[model samples]
Target: MSISVHLDRITDPIVAQDERHAGSSVRQPELRVLMATRYGRLGASSRLRLLQYAEPLAEQGILSTARPFLSDNYVKALYEGRSRLPAVLAAYARAPALRAAVQEHDIVWIEKELLPFLPALFERALLGANKKFILDFDDAWFLRYGGEGEAGGRNRLVRTLLGGKFPTLLRRAALTIVANETLRDWALRAGAANVLLLPTVVDLDHYPPTAMPTNPVFTIGWIGTPVTAPYLARLAEPLRQLSAEAPLELLVIGAPDFTLPGVTCRHLPWSEATEAAMISQCDVGIMPLPDDAWARGKSGYKLIQYMAAGRPTIGSPVGANTTIVEDGVTGFLAGPAATWADRLRRLRDDPPRRQAMGSAARLRVAADYALQATAPRLAAAIRSIAAR
Candidate 1:
């Protein structure tokens, strides 16, 4: 309940001292990192963005221990539309654990904060405890406290208390890693002293293209969580029009209820193992996002995954999507409903062009967006911050 109580519950003074001494010890070559992950590996921010650094950084002798605020059970329950009170309490209980883990490490890498919704001042015990804090953000969480995540009702009260603290967290952090340039600018405006842009990337070895589909039916695919499900709805009119003019099918992974009239909509649950195969199944992958501040902060992870799978992507011409899609090369950045239909028609009708784009997409990923390409940069950033 109280700060003292939490510290008393999990604080390990001996371990803390050992960590402090380890920092001065010249014998140790590896850097110990205590990662305050927002969720387990299932969460993209934690998995693709942060956790992927573990193996590569380890090779460079940076060992990391992840202490997740939310558990797998909490994520499963929340996605199922269940009450989040139990999960909230469970996550709250882990705050002290994370604080304790932060003690024996050279650096603390947090996805966001020690806990969301709590007052930003509460961060000092977990972060400001004389540690090199690497605060990583993959989304525009500042909007949540202002409006986005709040659904009115009693949650508004939570939003009010949690409001306006993202800036404070950025300012307090030793280093901030943001997913896009938009968020990096926000962090700079928030007074963050050090910031780095680390967009979401994929391991090509793990997500190489599958055998091209032999079916005559053209398939347009989308993969994301339920919250982004509505983004696909924005394409309904254009997709419906495209289907009427041609034989097109839709596969919605992670959103079971997503439907497009005149198109046969199929759904599949999101699974790490099957996600690559699912992306490969598409003749074209689509990422539709509204052009807004929140959308601008997106890292265009879906587009990268699609490109890595060697499926040409059709993305909204917004934020990082613009840079990743490489319009007319790896994919097209469709602006309006007509543009969406036009690009869909082009990719659908031109097999040679589509195959060329897919090949180029794979090459683009291998060149820039692959985990190997980015991991070294991240490790270098961490090393630079640590030395400072």
Candidate 2:
């Protein structure tokens, strides 16, 4: 299951590796990295953290070669309510091509595993061939397949078959990159010696705030995939109560079919080009989640986007939300379903508080959560691993 890391680099003789960690700085004119993403750009996890690195890393002499297991169209299928078996099979079919291309690269940056629902050892050949590897995670994926969730709890077959691979893969990677402390702690517990906490970020410059407030109604927004649309319902009753007293509207981007009874829900389809502009116009952003293990693994990218757009956010005090939102300073964090209504009312009634918090949010993003702040760390991690 293991081979000399030097085999993949070139025909150079074995170097003096008598005493050093696997990742040591070595000069290579150019480093080719095969980034095997679980899903294409439409996938937030892979898009923000891994795929976005292509151009930036190249400037550092690290060439990125992306091999997405799931096509963007496949995401369209999932939302269309089509059977996923075909797309899942197609991903598996590309295994050989992806594996064949691995040998030519200096390192394989695994954005999640090569394929889902497959045994961990399915990638044994790559390890056997001495391919250098790095693992990255923005979500608590271990709980998705291995912990409590619909995928693991109800679908016993999938849990039985594909669940155990993540821990095995975590232990095998040359280095692990995590988006938050929760996942970093899990990787450390999984026996990952080399782990990096690289938070997911937004390019603040690209998401400049709206020039002026022009919306017909004061908008409280939320953005995410349909799968997470249910969390929006958590705000339905709260928003309904606030709506009775305030001139507010709810914008749910990325979930055109989503509806919240008792609340005015404006569902808009999500597109890369329009995402920033759409979020920038919102007065406040909301991310409501039921306190659960799977929800805890979430990176709160929605909050990051809203904050980058200079919109204050209100989210459940869980996972990265606790760190990203500075409670009353950046945005409000609701403690329970009971307090949701009061929180929404405060933000809606006090425009001054909303504007101040939103400004703080944008400043926070520019200072710490900007892509400019974290991309270099990623380039360094990739460069160091490739050097090994």
What lDDT score belongs to each candidate, Candidate 1 first? 0.79, 0.76
TM-score of every candidate: 0.89, 0.89
Over the stretch 38-123, how does candidate 2's per-residue lDDT look in tens digits? 88988888888888878877866789889888887678788778888788777777777775788888788888777676778887
RMSD, one per candidate, in order: 8.1, 6.0
lDDT (C-alpha) at residue 321 in model 2: 87
Candidate 1, lDDT over the whole model: 0.79
User: What is candidate 1's lDDT per residue for 14-88, written digit by digit as tens?
Assistant: 323333444363543679998788889877788877787889889767899877788888777767778878988
- Candidate 1 worst ten-residue window by lDDT: 1-10
Clashes of each: 0, 0
Query: Which regions of candidate 1 deviate over 4 angstroms?
Result: 1-28, 147-160
The true-versus-predicted C-alpha distance at residue 46 of model 1, in Å, is 1.1
